[model samples]
Target: MAWVYLIVAGVLEIGWAVGLKLSHGLSLAKPVHTGLTVAAMAASVILLGLAARSLPIGTAYAIWVGIGAAGTAIAGMYLFDEPATVARIAAIGVIVAGVAALKLVS
Candidate 1:
């Protein structure tokens, strides 16, 4: 189903995002991390394409990116000990608002 594909795409997007960070800007273990990240990104694009075949582009894209953004923020805060300040939380609220607006307006 398109929803399944969308979910898969979102997961892949998060994987690629984390892989990119682990890639150390593609400096250390350049080939391995870069290749993994590239593969994950490609898989995400394919899954997204499949989802977009049925879902509206705006809606699907908003949902996909929203999941990725939320997942990444959580990972950053918990895994990387990154600051989860009020501003960071507010920015997440903005992202959620944007996704809600797209879903409503579409």
Candidate 2:
């Protein structure tokens, strides 16, 4: 399904986002880390393009970005200990709800 691909693409977007943090610039980036980051970035864009074929560009892009932001925020909290404040969690919840709403409306 188009939604499935979109979801996968969004997850991969999270991958690259976190990957960028871990990569720590080209100077410190390891071969494996850089490779995986590049691979995830490429795959995510490819899948996003595929999903756009069936969905409105604005809606698809919003959903993709929403999912990526939510996933990355949560991941950063757990993996990087960024922050786990209640307000931050609530914001993530709202983003998730918005993503769901867009999916339903579309």
Candidate 3:
């Protein structure tokens, strides 16, 4: 299903995003991590392209980004002990709500 591909794409988007952070700008630093980051980025984009063939591009892209943003932010708070302020949490909630609305409407 296209939705299944879209969901996989979204999750891999999160992986590549966090990988970018871990890659240290994909410099000479951490070569393995950098390579893996590139790989994840490729996979995410490919899956997204597949999903786009069947789904509305706008809705699909929005959901992809929504999943990436929210997943990364939550992982940052959980793994990196980043700030978990009320405002940031609420912003995440809004993103989630928007994603849900898109899913329901489209």
Candidate 4:
């Protein structure tokens, strides 16, 4: 149950991130992006709240943010043709490692 919420949170994080990009600084895609972003954030808050029952704040948050960053970066590169430099990949790796460490320590 908690894991489910966390997973939903992760997906919502992705949704909001993609929405932000499509928003084009909230100029053209204002309504669509704003609506999606707001919904995603609201979903995320509910998810984190549910996950708090079983997961530590530090651990859950690190995992959520790390997965969101890695997933979004990959999606941006493949779906949107954003840069996929070696350094960027390495940075994602580092973020994943940090998330893993958080889990391991707990």
Judged by lDDT against the true structure, how good is candidate 1?
A: 0.87
RMSD of 1: 2.3
lDDT of each: 0.87, 0.92, 0.89, 0.82
Tens digits of per-residue lDDT for model 1 on 1-106? 9988988998889888988888876555688998889899999999999999999998999889997998889788887899999999899888878867766775
**lDDT (C-alpha) at residue 103 in model 4:** 68
lDDT of 3 by residue, 25-79 (tens): 8876889989988898898889989999988999999999999999889988986
lDDT of 2 at 81: 89
Tell how far residue 5 is off in model 2, in angstroms.
Answer: 0.7
- TM-score of every candidate: 0.81, 0.95, 0.95, 0.84
Residue 9 in candidate 2 has what lDDT? 97
Question: How far in Å is the alpha carbon of 76 misplaced in model 1?
Answer: 1.0
**Cα error, candidate 3, residue 95 (Å):** 0.4
Q: What ordering of candidates by lDDT runs from best to worst?
A: 2, 3, 1, 4
Sliding window of 10 residues with minimal summed lDDT for model 3:
19-28
Candidate 3: residue pairs that collide: none
| Candidate 1 segments whose C-alpha is farther than 4 A from its true place | 93-106
Q: For residues 1-106, could you state the per-residue lDDT of candidate 2 as single tens digits?
A: 8899999999999999998888874334477777788899999999999999999998999999999999999999999989899999999999999999998999
List all candidate RMSDs to the true structure: 2.3, 1.1, 0.9, 1.9
Q: Per-residue CA lDDT of candidate 4, range 39-99, in tens?
A: 8878987898888779998778878887788889988998899999999999989987987
